[model samples]
Target chain A: MPSSEEVFEKVQAALMDALGVDDDEVTPEATMVGDLGAESIDFLDIVFKLEKAFGINIPREELFPDDILTNSSYVKDGTVTADGISELKARLPWADLSKFEKNPRVQNFGNLLTVNDLCRYVESKL
Target chain B: MRWFWIDRFEEFVVGKQATALKNVTYSEEPIDDYLPGRPHYPHSLIIEGMAQTGGILIAQMQDFHPKVVLAKIGKAEFNSIVVPGDQLRMTAKLMSLQSDGAIIEGHVTVNHQPLAEMELAFGILDDSFGDTSFFLPGGFFRILRSLRLFEVARHEDGSPIQIPDYMLEAVRQEAAQ
Candidate 1:
């Protein structure tokens, strides 16, 4: 199994290649969409690169829980409900959802994924 | 005025790699018109040629089921200018293939010299994009036939890649019409 640092490096490289961002810009705290300027399509490219780098199969839902976020049962108005937050916490144990929990707007969810979260996810898989 | 950038498929391996050739000639309108006096092929068209080469390779993997579109050009680097009379050979290798998208690494060469390199991303559109078909049935197949894609294409097991029945049926329907 790769160490946490190694996993972070591989994830960083994947993000850099996928988003055309520099190494320093891919700091652990950087938000994928906010800091790296990743679009929705870029995630597919990132997933492909990460899979290749770590020799792991990343199911789309594990990284992007679009279904959960979009489902009416989990969302009220534009925000994710308390149950939705619980589901997100369960689905994305690797991600830090504390900050997002305060607002939990479905739109805000896209920008919540950080580089550190990605590394943790990769480490979880390993 | 066909949008075809590639002249012919020189090599094709299903779901793997493809190589196509484009012979530039001064007779082409773009050569003289693009740069006024200097008659070199536009880099944009070179990228288009690579996209076509790579796009078709990705499409064939799914028997052209998914509406494959070039979503991004991750990287494009031109080492030398291509002039008329230059025979450009473009090879695209499938680097990654997934349900939502794919990536291909492409290289363009002229006379055994590296001319350009590209990394392209292709997206497979789902039904949300609308149920309309992008091409008239059998239209793309006719172009593929003209390019001799079936003649050169082969599966990994070395078996010949046959034209999909739907495409053939479309051809027959068009012929009957």
Candidate 2:
């Protein structure tokens, strides 16, 4: 299996390729929709890439989060600490954490989580 | 085929107006995936079909060069379930289009009754495919199609929409004369 870092790189590359843009368009500090510019369909396309890259199925339920995957600062104090999903399920109700996979609208379809956040979460599981 | 997701085109002309049709059938695998005994059209697939039809209309204006990716579905309302043996009336209107992409409010209807509706957006999938190095058999398309996630009729309308002069010229130049 590939490392989470590798997976994140793949996801980032996928976004740039699918959206027909460059890495500059989706910087770590850029929001998926605002700064980088992604609508819902574009969002769905991104999800497909993540699923393919990790060879994993994204629980559909996490498709959309109200304030997730936004263009936010992930780097703090000369290191990358702040991230997207941090705001996605930050208020998780526990039991619903497992249910997050079933809701496609959660965290705005994992938009808040950079490839790094996603790899971090996935790595923690391993 | 691996790809990414982009955003709505602020200048997309289909802001809220479009017209087309969707011919449904039992052969669609997604129906069986959701309900075997009572096969019904999955809502997402329905939207994907409509988005394809709408995206094609938008792309035709560019003479099949511009790759318009469906960005989002906004304000979708479902009145009832769709199944095989249904001819859907699909329509989409441009709400806006950015230099990078566009957004359109779209929907489908059966027997003149609204079945599904949404505000959809589309963006350009960059030159990633051209790079080839990132290309891989992701198997994502197969899985998605199995669930009826995507269905594009193998046909070409061959009609071009009115586009800006430069785009038309570019397509003409690309055309094999």
TM-scores for all predictions: 0.90, 0.41
- Interface quality of candidate 2 as DockQ: 0.10
Candidate 1: pairs in clash: none
Candidate 2, A50-126: lDDT as tens digits:
65566665443444433333333532333223343345456332113333344433333434544344454444433
Q: Lowest summed lDDT over 10 consecutive residues: which window, candidate 2 chain B?
A: B1-10
In terms of DockQ, the best-performing candidate is 1
Per-candidate Cα RMSD to the true structure, in Å, reads: 2.2, 17.4
Which lDDT value does model 2 have at A28? 48
lDDT of 1 by residue, B18-75 (tens): 9999999998888888999889999999899999999899888878777888899888
In angstroms and one decimal each, the interface RMSD of every candidate reads 1.2, 8.6
Model 1 spans > 4 angstroms off: A1-6, A76-79
For residues A1-126, write the lDDT of model 1, one tens digit per residue.
988889888998888888988999999999999999998779888887898999999998999898999999999999999999999999999999999999999989999999999999998998
How do the residues B58-103 of candidate 2 rate in per-residue lDDT, one tens digit apiece?
Answer: 5544433567776555446788998788767776665554445656
Give the poorly placed runs of model 2, Cα more than 4 Å off: A1-126, B1-17, B128-177
User: In order, what fnat does every candidate score?
Assistant: 0.28, 0.22
